[model samples]
Target: MDFALSQEQQMMQRLMRDICSDYGLEYWREKDEAKEFPHEIWDDLTEAGFTGLTIPEKYGGEGLGMEEIVAVGLALGRHGGGVSGPNMLTLGPVFGGISLTEHGNEDQKERWLPEIVDGAIVSLGLTEPDAGLDTAGIKTTAEKDGDEYVLNGTKIWTTGAHVSDYIVTLARTSPMEEGSRHQGISLFVVPSDADGITTNKIDKLSMRCLGSCEVVFDDVRVSEANLLGDEDSGFYHVLGTLNTERIIWSAIPLSAGELALDLAVDYAKEREAFERPIGKNQGVQFPLAESKMELETAKLMIYKAASLYDSGEDCSMEANAAKFIAARAGSNACDRAIQVHGGMGFADEYHVERLYRDVRLARVAPVSDELVKSFVSTNVLDLPRSY
Candidate 1:
């Protein structure tokens, strides 16, 4: 298959890189240090027409596909935004916009899609304190009361929820049936500012600018109109979006790894040791070379997954593999970059430490590496399913 980016895709990548370059590494470091949202950069992205990359043209979006989305995400990561920049896009335009575009009814689309394009941040609330990755095990309940649904549950790791305008939440609306754990789940677009909804920001080690949060819905009420897609079918709807998210998340590591490798290489070439540049030594050169190779290999998988998704093909295996490989490669690259820089790498000024913290999250959230391997074992290799 042809893996080369088309002219349009190349242009999109260049545009994203240019925009992201305007906000240098120092800006990212400051935001991370203060645990503040990159509101200025976010506004620039919205104004540059990136927040609407996946939404339909009828809703004031560019009507692009997953490939362009991945391109923009990678550019952000490579240009020093790391996971923070991509996370904002994913939480809002990519995840929220894609969910609404695919599942929302015409009225729902008209109501929410434009707002996202206009830079209304929307957070996803799926992982509860108990459920974790077992989405089927969530205890969040949305009980129907007359014409409204009252939601009660606590969602942990609700990224961007504190500042978001709305949250696309998944909750159990009915009793679980025998042997059907995935059923009874439903999705909703609950207003973040609604009464009874409270958000407490989580102090995180990485991706601090995104404001990962614990969002509590204590009898939070929403009209029937807020329901997204069919009740009891939310799990399937969420699965439909998972492949896209995996591909986007994979870009996090791909870009971060590339950036880290670049930094290490530049440092190696200039930093002198023993009366010569350290890069001349095989010890410094070997790890950077290995990281470059691994990062490039992972990048191909990311592009392949994105292509499959854009072409309307099933890509669960490819997407999962890409996420796993990319996360590992990116984290490893950052670790090695720190090693190459020695003591300076540990310092915040060099920025490798921040990238290291941010890249490490990819292996856990979005989906764990072990879970991805389990999926491959059961689904791809035709092995027995291991619970």
Candidate 2:
């Protein structure tokens, strides 16, 4: 039950903090305003080896695990990069690097891992038009055609497709088995520039820098070699990826919330009302204090899940709990910070507005807070399936 970070983990945290300091809040602010990806900051992180924390050393990565990645993400969020900073790692390192190393055979790893370490962006094409979080209900099909598979489908909320060189796509390779919707699903490493693949950016409320998109695949053909994991077993394999994602994702909003609170506290100390600073008022102090405690609690859970995952343990419950609690804690912290700042919180110059928008998206994305509760009710409480 050692809670302290190892020496290497601390160094990685310091490196991420230094990198974010180099970029500064204004860098993220300008990128968010322009709806452009922060290529410079990402390149810096890649050069520093933070981008490949989850990748194996043999593949030109740091050969670390979930615990180290969580630390890096938290540092990114706390040091002023917000969601976009941590998201760069998510696109390639967590999604591409982890997936390939865990499921892909030797040839697949030899081919993709080095490319990911070299800073290739990999977007996830999972959510379809008909299937939101219901991954098993995806309508996209990949029909076997001799030695190739012809893919035809529509994927919505495919984040970073515009900048991604590859998209880890999920498709139905065979008809559903009776009473088992999870069967027949398969994962593929689809090339972003393949013919018949059209990606149109979807304007969103928050985290605009990375961008989410609607991608259409009409008869996009991929070689059999691109298939990830055992055929019809992707549903099972992806479960591990999802758990890893949830665990590490806890840091993004958690970091954003901490940054927002810091801004609010700084403003409260200097902003005087009736000849006294607002920090003296209990009305202002209580909510900020509560947010601090809540965020602290969520941080512990996040690290617990990450450690368990790194140890090859089942962290499904811990991962969901961490994400659920962290999202609520982070979003609530941002809201309170806005209230504490009064009208200035609405202005982007203060940065709380952007933090609020970006952190709030965690409640519904990757997996909704509602679904997280549903998972607890069933898996943790031994209740019947609600959906």
lDDT of 2 by residue, 292-386 (tens): 99999999999999989989999999999999999999999999999999999999899999999998888997899999999999999999999
Against the hidden true structure, what lDDT does model 1 obtain?
0.90
Error of 2 at 158 (Å): 0.9
TM-score of each: 0.98, 0.99
Candidate 1's displacement at residue 252, Å, is 0.6
State residue 106's C-alpha deviation in candidate 1, in Å.
0.2
Per-residue C-alpha lDDT of model 1 across residues 235-310, encoded as one tens digit per residue = 9988868888899999987788888888899999999989999999999999999999999899899989988887
Each prediction's Cα lDDT score? 0.90, 0.91
For model 2, the stretches where C-alpha displacement exceeds 4 angstroms are none
lDDT: worst 10-residue window of model 1 = 86-95
